[model samples]
Target: MIACNFSFHYTSFKCEKNFGVFLAVITIDLTSISVTSAVISMAGKVMKKESLSIEGKQGEQVSLLIQNQIKKLLSLFENEPIQIKAVGVSVPGICYSKTGLVWAPNIPGWDNYPLLQDISYLLRGKNIRIKIDNNRTCCILGEHWQGAAKETKNAVYLAVGSGIGAGILIDGKILHGFNDAVGAIGWFAVDRTYKDAYSEKGCLESLASGKGIITRVKESLNIIDDYSGYFKDIKIQNLVIGDVFDAYKQKDPIAQKIIRESVELWGITAANIISAFNPEILIFGGGVFGPGIFFIDEIKSEAKKWAQPLSIDKVKFSPSQLGNNAGLFGAGHLALGRF
Candidate 1:
């Protein structure tokens, strides 16, 4: 048997089977759903159960891949007698709440695309309601929903990836500014002097992001007389995050200098987030932080310099427990409309 309750929070359908009740939730992460990738998963009451991926060039092929995977999940749930309570989707770019349109910079042809309508079209006869939001917001919400920030009303997730972004939760509500772009912290001005490149992705992001670290290293090497020590055999143009980390581990002077700057930038960014939101916990995640987790203590120590005296000491700084799955679970929480 199934019982459903409709409210502003979520339209939850409770499925009572012979042994227990199971609520099925579907979460789709479209961050990599471009000319090269996509990932979707299904979750029950506790954790993610299954997931699928798509890797190919962008075009009609990508659309078909998404639709086919969704259909398959729907069918799988239907056969298991599982009740899909809600569907939550996390987009890589800006998500217009009112119109369900998306503008993803990395995924071509998605500028203001009517993504919700397209998904709704696929479930024309179903009662499931879909909710969509940016991946940054999803990351924080995921933490609040089931990870580190659980039970906390105020928190922030500092996502340091190729670029920097943040997910803020204030007073138990996800903060979505007028343009639904509140967490685009990459553009935050943390530096006094600006350059042309800084204008492209913001001063903070251009200086502290993973790619930024690589760029700084490359530029530093070009101006110096030598790449002494472990950096001697490095290639600038092809430098990647792993290579930079390797160099850092080997105590390469250039890598050390660049990474030290990045750490300070991260700490400054954290201080800003702390001063603004006064969250209970400041969670760190994203690709850069995966290997860069070693710097958490230093980041915390640095944040103490600029953060609000009253709030800085009150908050906790920690790495994400959910890791890459933070956004996925956050999407599930969105579908359930639960804080």
Candidate 2:
């Protein structure tokens, strides 16, 4: 069996087995409102897992809740030590695992936090070791570990979730910039029109993040809610990208327009990336990608119109094969330095 945890700075995974029974792969996602945890056990080559999600307030309080959740997970396996080998973590921002320093955005009070030290302290003298990396890098590694890029040595993983980021792997190596911010593609400005409003920085995320999508929709329709569909039947605040996709599938004009605009922006951004990286494949993962994938072909078509023709032709675009498990999987891989 395998279990993993993700937080502001670290991601940890544990694998256990008892003769004929192996633990299943477990995945957890820690966001502002929700903290999801899972446990999986394996029998033979088949795997079975159970997962739970808890919604609560965001901010510092949420972090504490996550810590508690981790403690609970550890308690469950406290009596068994041989079943757990190592732990891995994936953070949202720049992470220097060697030093255990993490600088994250969404989670306040996490800047330059000594996450690995804290986790290690929490575990006391346990025989478990922890591994950590930036979420984007983890995403890329995760994809390579068990996702879309497994067969390709060179590929890029784009995470379009609450915020935008990328994980680049060239020649089978994850690129780490001087400050470990190599994949911080959210700040990349692709449109000059938003320069002034966005403070002269036109990060692709500013125009394409989940929040960006909602903001754009609001500005275009004067709607305050996130939903867009049969107006009276669906509330905007309750509308997520999935709901938007369903609306688009049902031929909702507003959903169609919003999706078209978002797709164009993504296409332009992807083209720029392809021109710069020229990877063998581009894997799209994260929460937004679930619905954004509906526009994959369209995005590629539009990317070709803007990107270097040769680069676009060289790269293939696809959805994440790991789905939500990319980070956890990458966490394990990072801890083991397997790839």
Candidate 3:
């Protein structure tokens, strides 16, 4: 059985079966749950509405929160037999499947954490199994399961959000490098010679990520105000990439500059991926892609300038049809493949 705020799809099994599997490809929404008393108390005074940083103890608190969420999900299947086959989870980070360690920068303390073993221990004696994968690989798997990449054996899915990453599928298999960081493109440097005033080298994320857009805007305008204009308000603490797109639509000079630079960076990255991987299709996903679609033609147009002429001509680009559900679907596929 699979459940989410969006929908629930359940499968029935025979009573003779003593085991079953539960797969979840969902993003962890931390804000929706309440933190522990200690965390809440520590967060006092320093915790701003939009930006709240917690200390190390928060990791255990978050682990408890996740355990509860999983319990709640498991409770839904109470009516059925208690046996469970396996649970496959897709997260937003570099997952080491062999050791079941997950390194997610966004989630503190998750770095090199034994997520699978821990979760399995939590479900011990339940006659169930658990597995995990990164969101990028899951996204592409979801697309292939029922979305635009259904028939393609070799494809790439780019997820552009707070950070940018890619999922590469070649010859119908997910490619995970030795360290399981094959698709981590955020660190891909665009400028070989360019370095930050602070001495940081060329990170693709510095130029193409959502944070990158805001940073660029700040550099250009030298204004500390949050992003606010025609399309959106400055309610959020920092400006998101969407605001940049809104500004572009309204013809804001700063927004235009940011878009032009960001798009070019994306094009260059795409060209490099195309040349290296030679994927048949390139699918774009994530929140940033919402505004990115409006600039697809421009992205492609610029990509043609830098991409290998033949390589660029062979690849097809399109938006992700699965949207947010791609990860969930992919998790299900991963679970299914386990059998």
Which prediction has the highest TM-score against the true structure? 1
Off by over 4 Å in 3: 1-58, 80-84, 196-202, 223-238
Residue 252: error of model 1 in Å?
Answer: 1.2
Q: Give TM per candidate.
A: 0.87, 0.80, 0.77
Worst 10 residues of 1 by lDDT: 1-10
Tens digit of lDDT per residue, candidate 3, span 236-318? 45666777788888897788877888888888888888889888899988777887877777778888888888989989998
- For each candidate, the alpha-carbon lDDT, in order, equals 0.75, 0.67, 0.64
Distance from true position, residue 103, model 1, in Å?
Answer: 1.5
Clash pairs for candidate 3: 20-84, 20-85, 21-85, 86-129, 87-129, 189-202
Write the residue-wise lDDT of candidate 2 on 1-339 in tens digits. 112222234333333465744433333345433545443232112122233443434344555555565666666665643244445567777766346677766666766766666666666776655656777887888788677888988899988987888999998788887767787888877776655545421367767788776666556556545654454476657656676667668877776787778888889889988999999999998899987777799999999999888889889999999887777667656654354
Error of 1 at 276 (Å): 1.1
lDDT of 3 at 189: 76
- Which residue ranges in model 1 land beyond 4 Å of their true spot? 1-21, 33-56, 59-61, 222-225, 228-238
